[model samples]
Target: MRFHVLTLFPEAFEGPVRHSMLGRAIQRGLLSVQIIDIRSYTHDIHGTADDYQFGGGHGMVLKPEPIFDAVSDTLSPYPTRDRHAFPVVLLSPQGRKLDQQLVLELATAPGLVLICGHYAGVDERVRTHLATHDISIGDYVLTGGELAAMVIIDAVSRFTPGVVGAADNVQEDSITSGLLQHPLYTRPSDFHGMTVPDVLLSGHHAQIDRWRREESLRRTLENRPDLLDSADLSLTDRAFLAGLGYVGISSLLDDGFESQE
Candidate 1:
């Protein structure tokens, strides 16, 4: 997968693109990131990419010319047939909430163009016409879209082959799995007064699998019960959750599994 990031603060990405899993993916040629400085496409000598907004705004708004030109120039090399399918994303607080499903959807694209809006935000034309996706990391606000762009890259990159070691690692991820992951323990079984669960050490694969599934459900119910509304749940899973006082268990039941309640 390839990511073309358009930002005024190109230097900000120097660290993220060079470290951790992103770094490894770039090294292995599984993923590539091209940072396009928005100012480079500006007309003036100072290369100013932002300007005071029309009809009076509190802060400067990103100019549409530089953004449009930058994106156009960055994608010029791609075959014309695939250009229409490319995702041109504008990171903003008012856009679609970033989630695992969206990340997976973006991973299917051969490449992406991420517009990191800054100042008061990009011109309305950029969002309305040029950007294919307007995405938000969460409900909260950030200083700029730089962090959000990095986040999208990391999240979407996980779905790319070889970006993460195991395909299961991405699929079974906390939010990706539609549930919080089960607890993990390593090294000495006993730590201070806490000891690892016996099922983990008993070498009983069946018992261990059951323990993991139950724990995953318990954690999700405790931390994010909203996921249960549409999470794929078997009768056994729903029964387990119901035993733990999940009231929504009354909604439906799978075939051949009568409610144990």
Candidate 2:
């Protein structure tokens, strides 16, 4: 798959997209990233891409013309290349919360068009008419959308078909299961004062599966209980959770949880 990024600081992406899994994916031809400098599309003499907000905002808002032109030029040959018009994703704090399901969905898209906003934010016109999706990494605000775009690009790219080491491992990831992942241990099974769980070393697959499931539920119940609300619990999973003192979803939503009913 291909990803086209529209940003004012295209140089910031040079080092990142060339290293680690994203780098490997690009090298292997499993993923492709094209960075387009929004300033390059600007018509002004100074290559300006932002202007003072009409209502008098504290910071300048990203101009819509350059962003629109950048996307238009980037997508002009998509149909001819057997690629669909990729979803235009605007990074914003007010957007839908980014999650595993959304990552999975985007990983499967033919391509992605990411617009990184700066200063105050992108103009509302760009959000309303240009972007097809808006995503937020979390509740807090960042200085710019570049970091959020990188976060998303890394997460989504790793799951794209041939980008990762194992397809099955990717599918069995923590959030995809709606539960925290079971502990992982590699060589030197003995570390510090801890030893690897015997079930893992015993070559007993059934027992290992059971242990992993129990541990997954336990970890989820402790660390991120809100996950239980949407978890696809099986009969065994429900029974295991019940045995661990989990009464229901509401009882686990908050940290230091307590139930009245």
- Global lDDT of each candidate: 0.89, 0.87
RMSDs, each prediction? 1.9, 4.2
Off by over 4 Å in 1: 249-261
Residue lDDT tens for model 2, 1-261: 888999998888999999988898899999889999999999979999999989685999999999999998999986855445478899999999998889888887888999999999999999999999999999999988888989989999877877878644776788876789999889888889689999999999999999998998899999998899988777677766766778777534344444444
lDDT string for model 1 (19-41, tens) is 99999899999999999999889
Model 2 pairs whose backbones collide: none
Q: Residue 85: error of model 2 in Å?
A: 3.9
Q: For model 1, where is the 10-residue window of minimal lDDT?
A: 249-258
Worst 10 residues of 2 by lDDT: 251-260
Candidate 2 residues lying further than 4 Å off, grouped into runs, are: 80-84, 249-261
